[model samples]
Target: MESRRTAVILPGRSYGAYVPQLFFPMLAAQRRGAEVRALDWKRLEELDTIKLDKIARWVSTQVAPVLKDCDPASTVVIGKSLGSYAAPLVARYGLPAIWVTPVLISQDVVDGIKDCAAPRLIVGGSADPVWDADQAFQLSDRVVEIPDADHGLMVDDLARSAAGLGKLATGAEHFLDSIGWTTS
Candidate 1:
């Protein structure tokens, strides 16, 4: 019997799966024949952003059910900003991940990424306060840092931001290929 490939998308507090950053990746995974599950945090406003532990736990709770039966080797997790709190869960499952604008300031988030042994791709912007380029490089060999982009990976120029997204997509594709996740 052939095993299944699963992709879980976790959106940031204000960023939904429909946003360009996530939407494109979701489409990429779907095109690869992986079952994609995009999670929407309905109660995002209620969560305390300052409490790293709480956010991590909440993220895990929300994603637990979706990943319950997934095989770590065949599963890929994609998270952005606040949703990066799921790092611990990804680490625990030893699953590959794409972290966009991850919260580098949070120790929990940093620690989780460090603990995860699977291949990971970290993308962020130089202008984003929460993004630390040096730290990102330390965590993963696959890193994409967009110049002058903010937390949304958007630059002063709309066209430039769009181009940045393109760069992100290319990076993601390369990472997927490196991990041998091909279209079925």
Candidate 2:
């Protein structure tokens, strides 16, 4: 019997898994018949005190348990902002990833994404302070850069932001399909 596919959803510092950015992709994963695991950080306050390079390790500690028995071949990780700190762990597991508005400012995060060999998709907005189009393209061939969206991929106009969100979801679906992960 084949193992079930799994998708782990990691939210940003302020953006919980239920938020539009993370929620829609999660729904897509579920729709594709993957078991979904959304993480809720209980000790967010501890992050402020941690060093930049060490943050990935901290994220790993929190995520390791959830991934204990998961098969890398059938697993994917979807993370946003702070949750992007799990890039190192994702790389270590060689799992395909959907990094939404990843923290490009952190060398650790950037390196993690760079080192990962699995198929990945990176989505970010040009308007976001931490988003670098050049680096995003360098990190992954599959990238979606919104013209004027922010960290949350939101723009000044609400309708435009909503449209951007739809674009992101579509990009994610395409990425998953390209990697041969579909409804089972």
Candidate 3:
């Protein structure tokens, strides 16, 4: 029997999994028959100190049980902004991933992605200070860079933001296809 395909969402601190930017793409993968799981850490917000490694560890702890029996090769992790801390766990599991507006300023995030053997698609905007498009390109040829887009990928023009959403969906679809995660 084929292993079940799973799509896990690791949302940014400010942006939850249901946010349109992260939600729509994960919904697309769900429509393709992948089980969608989201990790929410409310207590993290209340915590005073938020170190990168600690955040990643916390993410891994939240994610471990859900993925305990799942095949890493069949899993896809979608992480955004602060959620990008999970990148190291994704790499350790040897899973493909979709990173949107990741914290490239964190050397750990950059190094984790560099160490990931599975396919990865990094998305960011030139205007997002937290995102390093050059480093993203270096880590993965599969990258989507939106001009004038902010950390949330929202631009001054609503219509442009809508257009960027379309692009984000397309990029996600391409990643799914490349990974051979087909719909029934």
Candidate 4:
């Protein structure tokens, strides 16, 4: 079946090929009839390349091409934590990104972007110092802040219902519709 939505998920900064459990929310988007692809954080591996030439090559030759491959009309990038740095890269390549919980990127990186026109959504919580509600609101037209949601967001989930973490999407269709994501 042809996928109506191409949701590219970028995992947070966890050593190795580890994908976080928070990625579960993206499954919600998928269940709503979106095609989901996880961008292995491991693939980027080391952003801090010791070799100047290698660093330049990765961004231009490796990173740039991958981001550009996504078709803009059907794509939405969900970047969580460290992966947030990738949003701008994706935007530069023509895809919009929704930052889940952003971690600050280098000044050089921010300065590199001449323009940021991608459709963005920033979902954060009060407890995430790296991504406060105000910052998120400023960065994206849509921002959802969960009550007492922490950087991990698991604390809030556990408080609500420890056994029901995956249940966040029980009414996901309605939630998505309310957020302007139309289902076919």
Candidate number with greatest lDDT: 2
lDDT of each: 0.86, 0.89, 0.83, 0.53
- Top TM-score: which candidate number? 2
In model 2, which runs have C-alpha deviations exceeding 4 angstroms? Answer: none
TM-score winner, 3 or 4: 3
Which candidate model has the greater TM-score, 2 or 3? 2
Residue runs of model 4 more than 4 Å from their true location after superposition: 1-4, 15-24, 43-63, 104-115, 161-181
Off by over 4 Å in 3: none
Better of 1 and 3 by lDDT: 1
Candidate 3 lDDT, tens digit per residue, 9-62? 888887579887798679878978888888886687644576655766776677
- Model 2 scores a TM of 0.96
Model 4 per-residue lDDT tens digits across residues 27-76: 65676567777655444656665453343334444345455667776666
Ranking by TM-score: 2, 1, 3, 4
Deviation (Å) of 153 in candidate 2: 0.4
Q: Distance from true position, residue 161, model 2, in Å? A: 0.3
TM-score per candidate, in order? 0.94, 0.96, 0.92, 0.67
Tens-place lDDT per residue, model 2, 47-121, is: 899987788888888987877777887888999998888888888888889999999998988998999999899
